[model samples]
Target: MSTPEVSGALAPGTHSTGAHSTVTAPPEASTFRRWTSRCGWALAVAVPLWLAVGRLLTDSAGSLTPVYAATLAPTLLVLSLVALAVPARRPSGYPSSRACGILLISWGCGIVLGFTLPDVGEGASSVLGSWAGPGFEGAAAALSNPLGIIMLFMAVLGCVVSVRHSAHGDGSGRPRDTEEDEAQGTGYFPVLDV
Candidate 1:
């Protein structure tokens, strides 16, 4: 007697089953995401390098300038972008949550340090204090100056860009697929006898 065949759907151990059961994998991370991630890593790496080089190369007069403090915003922005872009190899809630928390903390620290530090200038501090609140009023008076204004603006812009970029995925803002999966594949239909 002949074995009964499954109908309409694929049967086990059949080539048709294998073909029809195929699954399409998710898409890889987008270029934008990758760029953001790399940018973050670069920023994190560059800051220490700058500090080390500045210490070794610059004299006291040059070292006192606000340039080092001014780099805070850009560094934080890059680090945050990196946290958002780098795809995790394995599923873990902690990594994502920790990353986000660190990003926020870094941004906050950058803004505070950039604004409150003595090198930033009094005039710029005053403006920031007036808008942000009284906590910065004293520093504002100390940091006021044209250069300080420009640096403050740049810092704000960096923060805004980093926050905006971190909210979305690569180009289309879609979630990236796991690296292990096949993002593109064909579907198959099979017929079977009852």
Candidate 2:
């Protein structure tokens, strides 16, 4: 008349190590996931430096020294957040999956907005005024450098790779078979014929 006291063991075919067996992702896939996340972390860290150096090298440009877009700050911050979200283990990846997705998206938004806004204003506060300004601070700013655009795109792409390799993808990372459950006496739902 009631569900038995089944401590709810792992379904089956999940590996036989102690205390962390619930994770079903294969060993190779797990290793690869960790690698991608690490790579993403590295790329995210480099974006600012790369952009700054590029700015510094550009000559014949006023506003000297080279100034980063407004979004650069936020993008750098979120890059860290996303890097941390990518976990070394499949089980750990589960909890931070959603956060990774969110931050990565924000990373894209920051790139687009940061590059666009400051240039628009040229010190002018109004939207129309900003766009109406001249020089790199104007509409042409976005197209000033192709490398910067590519780098920003890379940051977004890196975030995606980190998250995709995590638990957010399809069930291949984890699988539970009905037969396995029955054989283990767990039955997934744990029932018996009356």
Candidate 3:
């Protein structure tokens, strides 16, 4: 008798071979992602201002100005508005978990550096004071006065940017499963059906 034609599925011996196929779903952006993206954009804008106007606020050589500090919020506001205008995009092909882990590491490193770095002049004076008693306190005062503020701002901004970039999504700040592997059921490999 001829082997009953196994029609419904592939035959036991014969292989149903064809070109491999893959399915990819469009990425979806979330509100939180968008917010973070916007923050990133804002932070980008702030970088320049921090370098220019913000610098003036701390530099005694530049006529330490209260007005400069007052202008900071407005500058930040402008940056925020600019960021909001730009829509967030999903990351090209990065895994969210990996990105998050990297961000955490960067944040941790930044925290450690921020705490350990001697805050410019302050660090030097503090070192001197340890050896020569309180005479060097004035030299170290810069750390507590202006340098400390700038350092704090830098540390905070650096952490924010690191966290924002590490998180998935496009420039617009949305989480996207752009990686081929992520779309597939496998955590790190693209699913292929033959």
Candidate 4:
């Protein structure tokens, strides 16, 4: 007695031996995921160095205050860690939930920082006076100040990039993958079937 042929359903290198067929497991991680993880690590290392350089340039003595390091370093570290933790691929959808959450959090932080932290430059201090208070005026001042303005611009840019990233599954910022491409090529595995 003969069994039914499964047609073109077998994997690229899978060989059918009688009735018991061996199937190959998919890859542990996609190329995109691996790259994203690597990038996260790179960013984790680079951000502190970049911030330190900026601080040195800004200060005449090139000395870092303990308070400045304590506050800013941890905030940046957490943000970078969050970037590392976010998955490379997400379902195709408009205005990704994760992206929106991050944007909101950034906006809140920017506003709070504007209200609390003193302006750095003499020009900024002269223009935007002290706004530390629990009032609507403080919020308005936060939106108008230089730091707040830069933060708003950055948050918007992040939103646009995140939306684009969410639209593509592979996180390549490209169109969807096709089935024909998958079927035609031999993936990472070497073909064992003749």
The top-ranked prediction according to TM-score is: 2
Error of 3 at 11 (Å): 27
In the range 1-194, model 1's lDDT, one tens digit per residue, is 99787577444433342634534333354454444445545555444344323322322213334465356434544544444443332222112322333443444344444333332333332224545666766765464344345434543454444443333332222333443123333222123100
TM-score, prediction 2? 0.37
TM-score of each: 0.30, 0.37, 0.29, 0.34
In the order shown, the candidates' Cα RMSDs to the true structure are 14.4, 11.8, 12.9, 13.6
Which regions of candidate 3 fall more than 4 Å away from where they truly are? Answer: 1-22, 55-194
Q: What lDDT score belongs to each candidate, Candidate 1 first?
A: 0.40, 0.44, 0.37, 0.44
Q: For model 1, what is the error of residue 173's alpha carbon versus the real structure, in angstroms, after optimal superposition? A: 11
Q: Count the backbone clashes (under 3 Å) in each candidate.
A: 16, 1, 10, 0
Better of 3 and 4 by lDDT: 4
Model 1 misplacement above 4 A: 1-17, 47-115, 118-137, 140-194
TM-score of predicted structure 1: 0.30
Estimate, for each residue in 1-194, the C-alpha lDDT of model 4 and write its tens digit: 99987675677745667677664432344444454456545654454334323334333211333444555545555554444444343543233344444454544545344333333443222112332233443544455456545544555554555555554443434433444236647333324211
lDDT of 2 by residue, 1-194 (tens): 99666455656546446654555543333444445445546545554444333332322223422445345544664755464565444445432333344444544444444333332222332122234444445453444355345545655655554454453333122344576567768666434210
Query: In candidate 4, residue 31 scores what lDDT?
Result: 45
Could you arrange the candidates by TM-score from highest to lowest? 2, 4, 1, 3
